[model samples]
Target: MSFVREDMNIVIVGHVDHGKSTIIGRLLADTNSLPEGKLEQVKERCRRNSKPFEYAFLLDALKDEQEQGITIDAARCFFKTDRRDYIIIDAPGHIEFLKNMVTGASRAEVALLVIDANEGIQENSRRHGYLLSMLGIKNVVVLINKMDLVDYSEEVFNKIVKEYTEFLNKIDVEPNQYIPVSGFFGENIVASSEKTPWYSGSSVLEVLDGFDKEKLPDDKPFRMPVQAVYKFTGDGDNRRIVAGTIETGRIKVGDEVVFYPSGKRNKINSIELFNAEIPESAGAGSAIGFTFDEQIYVKRGEVVTIAGQPKPKVGNRIKVNLFWLGRQSMVKGKEYLLKVGTAKVPVRIEEITKVIDASNLQNAVKESIDRHDVAECILIAQKPIAYDLAQDIAQTSRFVIVDNYEIAGGGIILKDLEDDSAWLRDKVILRNNKWENSNISREERAEKYGQKQALICITGQKDVGKKSIAKELERKLFNDGRIVYFLGISNVLYGVDADIKHTDNDSREEHLRRLSEVSNILVDSGAIPIVTAVELSKGDVEIIETAVDSDRIIKVWVGEEVTTDIEYDLHIPNYDSLEAAVSKVKTLLQDRGIIFKPF
Candidate 1:
């Protein structure tokens, strides 16, 4: 019979020595999928060593695993049934290697959770079940292995099914089927076993074929995280192409796409391809590139979705269900790198709402997350990022936390928390959509003024010489034949804050919003708006960034000591001399390419 070549990735997970590897080996042997002479070679080696040959040894490829008689890594194997091919990922069953198991399981569409009938339910059995749910593998089958050891008793099998079913229900995971099988004796795997006559269910191989293949998310909204921006000017081909693999839905030529976080929208001009006919359309799983109708700056790591569809959440803070695996605990206020889709941004654990014990389904209050601890927590990113909720779009919601260059944790975003700048972000999106573009682009104006438009924010303590430094910087730039303006907070209070009473926190936020809006106008005019504010926090700058491009805003903290938690681009310690402070700021501008440097 001709079998379809379509493949599905499936993972086998359970407690250590519960026959996960042996079941995979049996599947290989029964399906005649093993390489020629591989099984015989293993049997010969076992004979020479005076040890009985076992199917588990077929998968224990690592020396450490063989010595310890346990899996240390996720081993992969391929096999085929009469219907389709299967890529079996034999994840390590040891508790210590739970990280490796999670890594393996996250890539699978289906999971086979093995539980030794003789050993009953173990710690890893429940933990693996919980992890399978967290990883979003909805297709599950419980393999009650080592049935021969339990004398193939229906009562024992039912008990295990009952206990495991209860545990799975707590985590909201329902197994597709619970089957009694013995991999060593090869009973109830490829064929039914008479020993378990009361148990009526399909064999392991039969159930595998019955599983539905995970379909591509083509039906969902179009979402593609920009992986790269390609420009091939070498062969007289000056097309600037934005390229990435589509995570969901479809995009066609002439379709309008909006990039998230920036909220920049543009129309597709043409689909670009390498030595082939450019297709009119592309769907999920296609690695495609397209040239836009306008030369809007699209950066790598920005998620692009078709306009008029559901928009993704754009914020700096998110609530997530995370599982930690770092050697050091995930502590609050410590910075780590959050990588979601192609975007990698600095992040910090803001709060741990509850830590869960996967084995017993217990919850605890914790300040830090230890290894293998699953927690529902809030994370604050250094800047805004775009993502969907895990329940909405699983692909875009999943993220990993990197600490000290090592993967420490992974999670799915449950929801985005409205940050301080959320209101400003909404206003900015509406403003951008309504604003008419000038024929003279910002780049053209930058060339004309010999400097890029920027907001050089002079921030520090109440008594610090922020105003003095701002005026000096403006004078220096003016002398250098550049367009510059010094905007004081007092300048806006009389005009913009004329009606609004500065009594509550809402008025304070509105003041900053008005200042940012004015600065946005100055920036668009290709002029530097040097503004001074007392003790500006990170949240203040974030609000300003909503109106202006964050990269165009240069934050300079002028003080003897930093009192607020603001990340500054340049820290001018003790602005004792106006010229000295202004010189330092000019040097920073030159280094940042905001101003042309001396030839």
Candidate 2:
């Protein structure tokens, strides 16, 4: 049988001065992947700096890095062995450059962790190893680099291997291979060394070549986050094609797909790769476009998945395990934008359950996650998003939190609690109860108003004439001698709750928390509140209703029905007619015993 080695991406990760760059340089040099004159430039630069030309100089291409003898960013290089072609991503080893490390590792299939044979496992060495595991890079090769410094002794290598292996095993990172090599002296890289007779093992290149690439898991549920929509017009016919890369799993022609959080469904008519209309199937790592049978609703950042597979939950609240990288400590109630794949959303840290100390992997009693700390917490987004558990699907599960333009933290979703209605309602109610009684008693407030039977919540998509309806309804209710609290969701989300900013999706959890808290205050104060949100999922509506302790919540479905249930689902025939929607809300309120006329 003829076998062809597929393309593989490998990243080299370790602490600074642990020879990550040297190992990559040596690999490129030994494999003859270096272009002619590249090494001469590095040598000439090193000479100008009045420093010896080290192998690491080859990858420190930046002028500042070459001057300081430190790597500030990740460098990518391509090399091929007789067995396979590989793209080596040399990730930064400094703790300050962890974001860069995550950037590089996000695109890699395997990681090579280089640890100093003499220094053993340092802070960043272990830190990068833990992050690699968290990022779902299962294939690892632990290179005990710089064996020459320890006299190439088998006893030293064995001891270091035993200690590091035990540590990694505790963190659930059992490397595929552990090799002793000296990247500086070219020992056990391409050829085995005779210095350590008892260390009988294949060279790094041999181990890499012998690695079972087929063992990597490629069988996941079909998930392709739509990146862009292509329209080839003016040719002959108008064509609209949705294009994106398959993050995981396989999609075949005629397979049913659902676009979310829109919940639009369509069938795959054809799969289109570059210059090819492949008939059969498309798998992970395939960047292709698809022509659907019908022009269903699809947009960028929406996850396209195989029907009947576990659908992504659309909600405001999510449980995540995060690693904070900002210089300032991550505090609760602060807003940020959460970026997952191509989706950028406003999010917030609702609560910090515990911070995991990376030094010992123990839960520490910390108020907030400081720089370079990992923590497990609950994150909530402002709008509903499609996501899976990190354990179930790695692609859609992981996300990055961006504050003001820079990435501050990265995390993986541990659970999706959209279906847990009881839990969701309880959280809202508890938070409301805490915020209550600060001003006045609910009964006293109810007595202050005359004849409003119950608090009603009017919710729908933003700019879907929600504010207009609210104003009209308030006018009708006022004419009927009833006090109406026209509390706009946007007003509360922006004005009274000014602490919560709608800058980006990173502060989503904080936004929801504040929004729900304010809405609860309004409802509990015995006023009819009209709230509007562009994308309120069924889960969010349920939570809001339960929080205010009222079944009077009415949902007007302006667009596609993303939610499951609504007391009054009004899909307007002509949204242009504001008078019709106002008339409907008045009748619905009257039917629920909310008398319009005091007489």
Candidate 3:
């Protein structure tokens, strides 16, 4: 006879030598979860080696490579009571394997934070507590272990509890209870021990059974990041499937679906499963596939949402709370891969807002994040990714950073900052979503024109002779058999914006937006548009670049007064002579293959 039993993943996390493995070993032994002869086999090996047998040695024997009692990888032990089955994930305690710790701990719904009763709270004890809150696992049970060594003293347990409770409260984590237990002796673990007569609380086994079952919150809005767009044409399979695990909400057949970052829209034709009855609808946590009513260009990393539901924020820059575990410090300007959900993009630390040393939870005066440092920073990526703030949606908000093919850091986005080009990007995405393709492709246009389109924006201080240099460069490029058009600043102000009032700073921004919009169309028509704006900020350049292709835009500052935040590709200090300045600008273009490389 079979009975239904739910599953709960619980992680045992804390400092090294805190008896995490021993607790797991004892739990398995006392519960009769282990197969017969398993415990005796481990004892026999220990006797042959002339070593005192330990319950932790039962787990150690199963460890194929790592010698330390601390679990290097996320090791799972299965046990079942009359109620439910538990997956006790043994997570590493050392800082060296923090990435592995996060890997195990993040997946757990509830956590067991074990601390040595004798040694007291260590650095990793606090650090792991901080990270557990960040990982969104709030149901924690503080297991004060090794009471046998501490002589089962209530004073010792209470002192550690008082200290650790204060720290946890500081980090916004209130553990369920502080339980005293001896993993080695099995005191107060499976049963209430007389050694602690002053204590009256549930046993470790009781607490384990009492934790709630993890469930998919289907009431929330639907979100499914495209894991893979499958097309199995071989072996007589013609149906293309969109495969993924729904992170939230539910989806049904015939429901309109939208894929974001691309903004493609379609309807679900059918839910697909192999050798199982087809599901009419799938809810959050369901790993299934569906065929679309229409073939949209869906691919991996695009988030799927119900067409009428709330949309995820799309941006390239965001502020995050991250912990760096890399051997090398997480320095600015170095490229790292940011992986959130299935989406991966090249990222860099745009700014270090604050760095907090996790060991002491104190602000550290640092320029770059070191190993095991928790930091609040801003990250700028090459392209926009769809996500929600961690406060709004927990699952979609977390990400990890990879350096040199290793996971060096992990973070949760606290908030989405205003990307300079957010408004323009939204317009661009909507425009692209509804854009009608011409019979002639962009490739055909480039092939026919013998040149790809580009934008060359010349900017600097107010008194800088931007127009003279821009016109001269355009004339020179035009004379050199290159297609170029120089659009004057006055023309943009008057021709593009003859109606809008010249009121306040917003008008200037609107003027630039219109200028970029018009110039972008011309660039797409196989023409290099030379635009000159005085004292244009880097933010201004970013706004224009959002309207066009970033790779196709060239920024040049013509004067020494670099007032704006722009990182210009080329700078000419002396703007006295138009011809010389124009020649210098042309040299940059030639070097960049914008015009022509020197033969």
1 versus 2: better TM-score goes to: 1
Find the candidate with the highest lDDT and give its number.
1
* Top candidate by TM-score: 1
As a TM-score, model 3 comes out at 0.75
Candidate ranking (TM-score, best to worst):
1, 3, 2
C-alpha RMSD between model 3 and the true structure: 7.0
Candidate 1: worst-modelled 10 consecutive residues by lDDT? 59-68
Clashing pairs in 1: none
Clashes of each: 0, 21, 0
Predicted candidate 2 versus true structure: per-residue lDDT over 396-461, tens digit per residue: 899999877899889799987653443454464344223313344333454577544354455555
* lDDT of every model, 2 decimals: 0.87, 0.74, 0.85
lDDT, candidate 2, at 320: 90
What are the runs in model 3 whose C-alpha is more than 4 Å off?
1-3, 65-70, 234-237, 432-599
Q: Where in model 2 is the C-alpha error above 4 Å?
A: 1-5, 44-50, 61-64, 214-218, 277-280, 419-599
**Candidate 1 structure quality by residue, lDDT tens digits, 102-182:** 778888998999999999999888888888898899999999999999899999999999988988888899899999999
